[model samples]
Target: MAAEAQSEGGLVFHPLDQFKIYSLFGENPIQWYTPTNVTLWMALAVFCIVGLFVFGTRGRSVIPTRVQSVAELADGFIYKMVEDVAGCEGVKYFPYIFTVFLFILFSNFLGLIPGSFTPTSHIAVTAILGFGVFICVTVLGFVLNGAHFLGLFWMKDAPLVLRPIIAVIELISYFVRPVSHSIRLAGNIMAGHAVIKVFAAFAPMILISGIGIVVTPVSVLAITAIYGLEVLVAFIQAYVFTILTCVYLKDALHPAH
Candidate 1:
């Protein structure tokens, strides 16, 4: 819960409280089996994806419905992205990439709803996604290329003396991919939501104090602007995450420079 303090002006703000996770059940210590807001939102994202692909387009028709059209567009979009970024071999992995895209896309859009939770705003959720992709690509690279997979970090183009230094830097960066990947998504989502919440808090200023007249209108305008930007950011972040995954897959499939 958001901590609140009373003052002479009766104004307060705790924007970060919206991201807190709490069990659906009574107040108790969380466990693996506990159902939290994160679980609810993640499940909702999955259901939305299934609904769009399965039920939304269950009936194949010559003249498609709006939902079917959207479904097709999304499918084609991801397919082309995979093929273009990772090449034809990566097409075989399109389903995995598409699934990740849908989950993140849906979660981001859904989180924009009032009073709803954003699973992507949490590091735990994003870390799982980032690390899962990292692990998958690493294993696939080795399975497909054997010891040659190490080529991903080796810099043969550099001069003999600089090769080892470049390789060491590349090796560290390779391991850091998951950390950077996960934090990028979580940090952006959290920052946007927190900023929105801060503006929302000021929205009530008009009713609380005399200085609120100016604060309220500015806050509302800021909130509106930020909200619009956030809508775009929601899609861009998903696209970035998915495309990066494709890039990683491309590296795995062809580890050679």
Candidate 2:
């Protein structure tokens, strides 16, 4: 904790520092085209998705291998989700929803590794995803339903005096969907990673200092508990995001529903 020791001892925590974006290569200024940790992890996620789903399932058999079985299971799960939430018509966009879920799920799991970046933790990434859903659904609604899409905002069932207020509230909530959607994913992802990092910072203290013995076990236990929870959260967040997307698509496809 002294000026000389810097990060050496006495519970000097730097949890958020783990989320810093930087290039893997060196200490150079990043450019628009610069390949950073985010790009690396995103590409790795994509690679894993393809390798597991594509190559792993290439050999179709009467009795499926473990990898093929997993691929098939995931496919079936999301396929059913789209159909149930967005209806049979929404099944056409299965590939998009599946890819989004896979990428986020993989990004989250990869981040649990000792030295890995989580692309989904960044607002920039999540915002793009959130806004993309917003824009896509909004456009699809307009395209499919034309002016009738505005019925989503109008609350005809409400009393005559309250219908205008309800419409206004619904319109605002609809427009705010992207912001809320993006923050939900990014906040959940960032908070979990930051908690793990905080616990991990304490583990190093025991190796060189007297206070480590007490802190190390606690840190390890906390990390393990949170890590296991994060595993569940990873899938849940992916599922929530995808299911919500399906719901929005349903609204777009059938605004009155």
Candidate 3:
């Protein structure tokens, strides 16, 4: 397939070829327990997290190491975010929120590798994360607030006549949260990576003398810029997902309004 793309004089780019799933070993067929690219990257992400928090910070020294400092900073950051967003009550769930943040953050950054597969770019993975949050918060909301959790759908501040209409809208939006949350992360990461792929594909193809100079340079610049942007985006998307989870947890904890 790659050879075919290069055969013609025209430059053909398969931007999405990066996202295709393949077994780590010989391609027999993917089974329920098959080790694919997605599984490998995700496992790598998990190992990285463990290395940072466990081995990295194993020494409880007064003078911290770089790894320890980073671990401390991340913990403090997410702790503060939860406390601020969900109030003092939300602090209890810090570990869960922090885990989610680290997993997504690590996955996003790891996917930036030259030939790495992004697990978060796939809907199957993100959907699990998204719906997992959805289910947890939904169940927690009902468990904590009981019938008051349903009050989340009803706006008491709105007009008497508009309450029912607003409730319906809120109900729909509430259900749509998982879909939007998962898609938002997957879509942004996938789009950014695909754009970079397109630029990269053009960078090495010197088809014509005159156009190659301009095209190659421009493609290189675009790839560089987009790659840098994607790094920032990786962090931002992780932050966004974590903050949204906190917001949902806040709603679950206090479903009054």
Candidate 4:
């Protein structure tokens, strides 16, 4: 969800077209070091996160300023989430989880801007993140619990005959985790942006058609509502993703039950 593209049509009606990635420098082919909308937006998101959490609250005053208060609130909230969901040992990884939440949250909010890109809306970005977590937790499980980590897929408490079958199903489900995780976030971000674009297309109709009096207001109102909901969804999805990571971490730390 980066960079704007023009349409051959009189007015570009393609809502999904905003997601395309092109080189920021020139029309040359993309390479490993090539700068694109995705990289720009992701870097911007990181900058925003650091600015808010680090510089914004650097003072740590007795009576906090607005930015300080917000930074503290976010820090405390994610800290509690990690403690509660992943337990004591998980606190060691709080920094990693917290960084993930901030990056996604910042990207989601920044994408709301008129001409900004949303890296979080792309599957390529989200898939890497999801798979990274999956790998971390799986490897952590094996390292921490040794051969006992395989017990996660073993339904020992199940009926004798169904145990083996259940293990296979569990194994498949385990592998599928990253796919669902990546799609859920990317799908939601893309869908919301597309819906907004669709509603926005109607705004120009007011000047083109005489009957736009009714259509324009309806479209504007719908856009406003959806935009507000998208704001909420941005936070909710970030929180959901973070908390689910904590849950998976817990599973890795304690695969016995």
lDDT of 4 by residue, 1-257 (tens): 12242322223466887898989998999998999998899889889888888899999899998999999999999999999999999999999999899988999999988767889999998998899999999999999999999999898899989999999999999999999988889999999999999888877667766777998899999999999999999889889889989999999999988
Worst 10 residues of 1 by lDDT: 1-10
User: Per-residue error at 203 for model 4, in Å?
Assistant: 2.4
Clashing pairs in 1: none
Clashing pairs in 3: none
Give one digit per residue, the lDDT tens place, for model 3 in 54-172. Answer: 99899988899999999999999999999999999999999999989999999999999999999999999899999999999999999999999999988889999999999999999
State the lDDT of candidate 2 residue by residue for 59-173, as single tens digits: 9876999999999999999999999989999999999999889988999888878778899999999999999999999999999999999999887787999888989899999
Q: Whose lDDT is higher: candidate 1's or candidate 2's?
A: 1
Candidate 1, residues 1-257, lDDT tens digits: the string is 23334455565677898999999889998999899888899899889988988998988877988999999999999999999999999999999999899989999999999899999999998999999999999999999999999988887787999888898999999999999999999999999999999898889888988889999999999999999999999999999999999999999999997
lDDT computed for candidate 3: 0.93
Q: What are the runs in model 2 whose C-alpha is more than 4 Å off?
A: 1-9, 205-212
Which structure is stronger by TM-score: 1 or 4?
1
The reply for model 3, stretches above 4 Å from the true place, is: 1-8
TM-score of each: 0.95, 0.93, 0.95, 0.92
Clashing pairs counted in every model: 0, 1, 0, 0
lDDT of 3 at 127: 97
